[model samples]
Target: MEINIASGLLAALGHESRLAIFRLLVEAGPDGINASGIGEKMGMAPATLSFHLSHLSRVGLIEGKREHRFIHYSANFAVMDELIAFLTRNCCQGIGCLPKSFACNTPEGTSSQHGETC
Candidate 1:
């Protein structure tokens, strides 16, 4: 969760295509989706999908595992969790100014209760 690491993650996701790819992978969950499936689902060419996938993998946002001839990509949930915690670490300034219902949503769209810090 260092600044450089967080910055790299954010920068990698800054692009529209990469963001979409990441979102799709996040939605795919731990089992992930293969390269062909990702490209097909996103309507992206193989080369374009490869580029985005490489970038995401380089930044540690996504991980690729070889499953026979295909490579399955899944979001790195640990890194994602760290990034989320880092972003929301200072929320409410420790004074609880936000409502009690205020919570941070993980990549899976599930709400995580935040006591004082994320």
Candidate 2:
């Protein structure tokens, strides 16, 4: 990913509400969740949810598809993966700095028990 693209994506995710929305969409997987469902699950008002969702969509972090009366939102995994790859492109200067047991802790500080070797 180009720096400008990565920066834009990062800037979009920088907002608290947008980050939460994106995280929820990521958790929902490719099928995604509609605006109403996302609002309900996040205790967000419809307008607020819409704002965040739109911001994510504008930055290519999320994609919204019209499904009849509702719009289902899903994380744009291609862009996400690109962002991840960009961030870690030269990790550890090509050395295997990340151990197999590297921890990706959750918000609660518990280890995810998942790791990727460099």
Candidate 3:
């Protein structure tokens, strides 16, 4: 992940609404969720949700596919994984720094529990 691309993704997630939307999509997994479902779950107005979704999509953090009249959104896991790899590439200066019991069992780009990439 180049700095510019990473910066763009980070900027898109910088907004509270966008972050929430991304997290929600991650939780929804590969199946994804439609725009209306996202708005309903997040208690956001359609316009507000649309704006955030557009930003996220533009940054390649999320993707949308048309299914009937609804557009289902899901996280772009490849980009997400690259971002995580970039961020942690220098962890502990290439030395094992975490505790011995600390196992990063989390999926490539997601949280430990349900696979939510940071």
Candidate 4:
């Protein structure tokens, strides 16, 4: 991903609520979760959740599909992959640096996981 694009994605995730919302969607998998589900899980106000969701969607970090009555939102895995690759493009100066492998996410799981040290 280009620097500008990566920066924009990062900026969108900079907010605490937005990050939480994004992670929830990521763990929700490709099918995603609706705004109400997200609000309930995150305990966020509807208007606040809507604002964060809009920011995430605007940044291409998440995509929403209209179900019968509500929109189901899912993480844009393609864009997420690009962002991760860009962030770690120079991983360990092209070699291993960290001494330990780090789990990518909490028990819910995420898009990427590194089993070995980079």
**Candidate 2 per-residue C-alpha lDDT over 1-118 given as tens digits, one digit per residue, 9 for 90 to 100:** 7899999999999988889889999999999999999999999998888888888998899999999999999999999999999988988897655544344334544344333322
RMSD of 4: 4.3
lDDT of 2 at 48: 86
Q: Report lDDT (CA) for all predictions.
A: 0.86, 0.85, 0.85, 0.87
Give one digit per residue, the lDDT tens place, for model 1 in 1-118.
Answer: 7999999999998999999999998999999999999999999998999999999999899999998998999999999999989987887886644453454334544344444443
After TM-score superposition, the amount by which residue 89's alpha carbon in candidate 1 deviates from its true location, in angstroms, is 0.6
lDDT string for model 4 (14-37, tens) is 999999899998898999999999
Off by over 4 Å in 2: 99-118
Give lDDT for model 4.
0.87
TM-score of each: 0.81, 0.83, 0.82, 0.83
| Pairs with steric clashes in candidate 1 | none
TM-score of structure candidate 3: 0.82
Q: Which of candidates 3 and 4 is the stronger one according to lDDT?
A: 4
lDDT of 2 at 16: 88
**Model 3 residue 20 distance off true place after TM-score fit, in angstroms:** 0.6
Better of 1 and 3 by TM-score: 3
Top lDDT hit = 4
Q: If candidate 2 were superposed on the true structure by all CA atoms, what would the RMSD be?
A: 4.6
Model 4, poorest ten-residue lDDT window? 109-118
lDDT, model 2? 0.85
Residue 53 local lDDT, model 2 = 87
